[model samples]
Target: MIDKSDVETNVVVITGAAGLIGKAFVRAVAQTGAIVIAADIDLSAAEVVANDLQDLGKVETAYLDITCPKSVDILIADLMDKHGRIDAVVNNAYPRNANYGRKLEEVTYADFSENMNLHLGGCFLIAQKFCAAFKAQGFGNVVNMSSIYGVIAPRFEVYDGTAMTMPVEYAAIKSAVLHLTKYFAQYFKGTGIRVNAISPGGIFADQPKSFLDAYGSRCAGKGMLDPQDIANTLVFLLSDQSRYITGQNLIVDDGYAL
Candidate 1:
């Protein structure tokens, strides 16, 4: 049992709060008594997550399209009015399936732009708005989600006697988010707002078996890392436990990168 007083009354805004990692994050922080604003493009999914955690702590569901500036601004303003200050924001929303394992030449420009906008542009806009709020309040945390592919190249694996490759756009956008984390962290230095990132290797929940099989083979036959692994790291970053850490990309890959 977590001590509620330790994290009580903190307001956390989590985008993509309906997905695997996002749901896990909601449960984790709610257990510690933090009020979570579950924001997602999927309003129904967000409502489910919010309802599930309502007994633990206050949760409000909001329909958020991170790709749209007006939508993002409206949500931020509403949260600010209601909560007075946002203690932290977990940017767990991703636009598309970057794990299609398509080759660079096979990936379309539309695919590249969509992924870039969600990962890079979304992070930039959210960080900018959240930092403004944090500046006024004098404290906040921003946790951007990245992938192990952001730090290293994907490995080729032979599956069913055929070689498969990871998509280039996935790697590119994640890599961009990693740097954006550093940029935001540095830009807001001494402002009491910490910006950081979590680069998870692979999370297997709800993924297609074929993709998992190929990825597992590439990872030396290991299972995907648990969502809890990423969630725990996120909680630490959002909590006072990581008050001194910023501009760092924390990897939670269970040695898949090794």
Candidate 2:
């Protein structure tokens, strides 16, 4: 199939548009000439991103707290009314508390449940509403963001000389998201709806040198990922390029999973 933008009805809604990867996703999709809604909890930040991409394509910003159903409904409904269609949704918004990204011992039962519920529950609600609407409209696509930790066990050695112990809840939440993506793919098999996920490896960030070297040893080349790496794959999944792919968790971890 050719580009979905060829139809002039490609409107992509990306949640968490202010986050690292979220911003990259907006830019990548905007380059394709599709109408992109950079929805996020920080409306001002989203607006800035949309404004920066105005020259590339049609981009707009809106407030959306993916963890809130009413907020999700309001945004989607408004977008459909204004754009006439919402061809795809990238579920990349993650609501985290101040104690987020804590180590295993630092994690509480409450923290674990809260994070998982916020992520997986929000995905369920958003996908439910989007799918129901898409069912009547004829087609839709969803891309959930999982993590490499969701696929393979974390290498505890990488954090040996660093303060970077992966979050316990992160693995559980991402793993749940992977299965949920699969369930929706099967659940909506004949409805022209595609559900897929991206399981990303660690991206390059300011970490201890020891941690980086240790992690690098396990990778094929680069130890960390660039936001563009994930953005490229996201565009493919959202575009007609991957119209036939569904229920797949495509990993973009620089071979860290190997």
The most accurate candidate by TM-score is 2
Residue pairs whose backbone atoms clash in candidate 2: none
Expressed as tens digits, the lDDT of each residue in 58-85 for candidate 1 is 7888998887889988998998888788
Best by lDDT, which number?
Answer: 2
C-alpha lDDT (0 to 100) for residue 188 of candidate 2: 94
Least lDDT summed over 10 consecutive residues: which range in candidate 2? 1-10
Residue range with the least summed lDDT across 10 consecutive positions in model 1 = 156-165
Runs in model 2 with CA error above 4 Å? Answer: 1-8
Candidate 2 per-residue lDDT over residues 1-258, each given as its tens digit: 447464245898898899889989999888888888899989999988988878888888999988888998898889888878889999898887678788897888887888888877887877888888788788999899999999988788889877778888888888989999999999999999999999988877687889889988989998798899899889889877788999999999888899
**lDDT of each candidate versus the true structure:** 0.83, 0.86
